[model samples]
Target: MKLLTLRLTQNMHARSSLLALALCVGATSGEGALGIFEDHADIGATRRAGSAEYHAATQAYTVSGGGENMWFTNDAFHFVWKRVSGDVTLAADISFPTAGGNAHRKACLLIRQSLEPESAYADAVVHGDGLTSLQYRETRNARTYEIQSGVSGPKRLRIEKRGKYVSMSIAAEGEPLH
Candidate 1:
């Protein structure tokens, strides 16, 4: 599959989880009824409300929100998710609708243990500035960590989970995922 994973081995943390895509959510989540996603939410506090809109013609989901960050032991962002058991993978071609916003703004394909900001999770993320990386937390409330990709400005970010391992891959413009 093209949309998929991380260098962090199975030893990092071993727990099953549900997957999410940042493209769409209700309580603070279910409102993001965009195509494939069943629910959505704003994880953690934010300065303003966030939203997910699906464009049928273009088959794209536009998700926007504000948060302090998705780092450390907590995360703040709009989460478009569906809970499922077993291994899963998700991929997205991320782009900021407008330019010159927070360089750290991230669009991610995520798998979270729970909706809480402190949930254990894994993601393939691309920042506003085109930095792509694989990020994850080992356990609930654990510190988040990542391994940056040497390649930047990729057109697609993919995340995958298999057993206790998670990994990520990217494809640059006109290039295949490695």
Candidate 2:
């Protein structure tokens, strides 16, 4: 899956609110029509809110939003998801439209229990500052932690989950998965 191009500017507060409104009304309805992701899910109830839009021609999704953080005991970002059990693999090409957003801003491939803000989950994330890591919450409302990767600013990322194990991989633009 190819995800959104976050274009964060100086007006973060206004943009966040607008993103939420747009996601609530436009994300699901129009997004699926353009075949971005199979479905959408909300988790953690974000403070600033976010949205997702799909561009059919490019086969990419443009997602935007703001949150205090996706750490500690809870998270606050928009999620695009589909239900599955057992083992699964997710891959995506991600990028930002501009270079001026929050350094901690992220695009991720996430797997979680439910829509609860503090639900147990694991994800492979690429941060705005080019840090890539595997972040997870062991249990509901648990403190969030991460195991950082050596790679940074990868253009593609992948996450795989099998039973209790989760793994992440990254690659540069136009390169093979590592």
Candidate 3:
């Protein structure tokens, strides 16, 4: 005799948010796959909903969401992540689908401590207007701070973590990480 079986595994938070997401955006499991990350969107203090889709042919990910800002003590934005320890590097080529959106709307390569709204984190982000910066919050619920970069409208952004230090680099498409 032969038998077939199915297995399901999910974190409690992720399962709960997935349910809320279905009701809020009618999103499906396939629609939220962002290439490397199985989970998309962090349920936080946000007034809007977000979604992400991955295109295997082009090896690209598209994420869209609305948030007042990624500043202050808390944030509200779509995040796709995989937990990692020790040193790591994250880089991505990001662009907006339309020219019209909040000037502050941003795409980022982020490393966070937790899914909490005010988790200690750092990221290299590209804003709608081409502004690039390294933003971080050292402690939970603490004020966020930024170190603005000279590069503007970079087609690629990278953030690397080594020990307690984090560095950022940006470049135009086809250019080396600077």
Candidate 4:
């Protein structure tokens, strides 16, 4: 199956589009939502907003800590929404430009976000170790579930939540996870 890969250049507009695509399709995240990046935690850098750089050719994003840099924290980034309802699904094409030093950078679907923008729920992340998994954060404690996945170009990450059950699925293309 051909991956739904999007080459992300250093285009702010493209990044914004990618952000929208990552958030709009799914229902609002609920507390105990169980996803990834439950808040506005920075993926690569904690101090610089939008510090990560995107490469169009490889469709990957890169970031380094500088000025208050820290490992990926839920407080530094999050998908903000006024309210979330119904079933939710997100498809992302992500890549990592570099990795190391507790970078823990990732691209995935964030959900159950509060309107505040500083808090929400997240799932589906491609870690710095080139591993993909699902995780959630509550009061500085993050719980991650290691799942077998190939982290590379044009990777597709998905999340679905219905009632009290939430599930994560990843694929390049060829039939959505059921």
Q: Which candidate is the best by TM-score?
A: 1
* lDDT-best of 2 and 3: 2
- Indicate the residue-level lDDT of 136 in model 3: 92
| Candidate 2 global TM-score | 0.79
Q: What C-alpha lDDT does candidate 1 achieve relative to the native structure?
A: 0.64
- Model 2 Cα lDDT, one tens digit per residue, 73-120: 977766765556777676667777777566766777777777677888
Q: lDDT per residue, candidate 4, 23-80, as tens digits?
A: 4443333332212223222332233344333344553434322222112343333222
Q: Which candidate, 3 or 4, would have the higher lDDT against the true structure? A: 3
- What lDDT is reached at residue 97 by model 4? 39
The list of candidate 2 runs beyond 4 A from truth reads 1-11, 14-31, 34-38
Clash number for candidate 4: 19
Q: Where is the poorest 10-residue window by lDDT in model 4?
A: 12-21
**Between candidates 1 and 2, the TM-score winner:** 1
Please, what is the whole-model Cα lDDT of each candidate in the order they appear?
A: 0.64, 0.64, 0.61, 0.42
How close is every model to the real structure, measured as TM-score?
A: 0.80, 0.79, 0.78, 0.51
Worst 10 residues of 1 by lDDT: 7-16
